[model samples]
Target: MTPATSNGWLLETRGLTKRFGGLVAVDGLPLAVRPGEVRGLIGPNGSGKTTTVNLLSGLYRADAGEIELRGERIDRLRPHEVSARGVARTFQTPKVFGNMTVLENVLLPALAALDRGGHRPRSEILEHARGLLEVVTLDRQRHALAKELSGGQSMLLQIARGLMVRPIHLFLMDEPFAGVHPTIKDIIMETILRMNRAEGVTFLIVSHEMATLRRLCERVSVMHEGKLIAEGSFEEIANHAVVLEAYLGR
Candidate 1:
């Protein structure tokens, strides 16, 4: 895939800076994600990867910066407001409602964001939920309680739930493969690629798994000590001396 230029970016963050008390978490970060592009964010611990996601998702207000989703400024919006604007994200831990059935969890987003004329009938919503479950290969467990699912299954369900929002711009995924098994990890990765290709869902994935990130992302951004120190294709980041030292102590 070609790199997203400034003009065609679906999501753009300019001078995005965030701070917690005296500690700067994300410093003057600038990023652009194109429609349908899967960009990876990789950095060592305490590199502000999760902090950046929080800021973008409106969990934390930026001390400075601007975030635009499809050219609309959204940095100051509340989390739910951000969601309503077509931005969806999955946390590192599955955030599904534990007491809800798998299908119910998937349907919640759609129900919450129902607009005046766009609301579907109950039967149609159920069918749509089932289709989302099928996309994640979780239709077999659609009737099960969310809390009963394994870690990997819960992760897939989280992604499916995010899709229920019908996002058009971006999906911010935080450490999606952190604790998943290799087989399940492959399933999730493949599903992500398929979604990007089939539905034009842009992604900004944060992960420590270099191999997985390299395989899944066309471009990568490396953060360290609250700063975005590098941004380029995986090969460029992998070969950078600073990145090598950051990952492997000199």
Candidate 2:
């Protein structure tokens, strides 16, 4: 469902398109995400969900169109520049620094951002890192090496690391619950909800979990063959005849 607001979207894309070689990965994708809103993106394999994420995250340059964050144009920013502009993302596979301690991996982004801002105090950075670890419930594992953590813990670490930048918008989560234990999945989901509620972080999540998406997302966008096929509330899209036929391979 659209949030009750007039012209108050936090992120919007106008005719976003991307292509590679002879393939059109995404085509004329128009979407809007309000502040603190959770929007789900779903589609069958090769439907361009990941490609859309890549374009939004600045990992891939758009072949056409623009992206606006809080109404500021940001489609041309580099990936790191995008992060600095209050956009952060977590990959489908956790990319923890295996050689570093759990705390170090989480601390990297905060420290880097701070250093770039001309802050060079080690004690201050350490303290900030500790706080982030606490936020993700990883303070107890502060000294543990990244590679030693379980899959769920790794996912938590990835999210915690993303938050270290204090992003206003987040994108690029794919199959977040994949291969994680049920309890850990619950923890991850709870953390996501808490971030949105308490910090006003906007999210564009990509996943195949219909039940989870229906429960968490205010709006759902479905893609097919690199084009947006449906856009509506979860119930509206879930009950759509086209969606059923697409999912059931009819």
Best by lDDT: 1
lDDT of 1 by residue, 64-160 (tens): 9999887789999998788877778999878889999998899887777665345567777778789889988899999899999999899999988
Q: Residue by residue across 2-58, what tens digits does model 2's lDDT show?
A: 242456887788999998889988998888877777889998888898888888888
Which numbered prediction scores highest in TM-score against the true structure?
Answer: 1
lDDT of 1: 0.85
In model 1, the clashing pairs are: none
For candidate 1, the per-residue lDDT at 35 reads 78
Give the count of colliding residue pairs in each prediction. 0, 1
Candidate 2 regions exceeding 4 Å error are 1-6, 118-125
Model 2: residue 52 alpha-carbon error in angstroms: 1.3
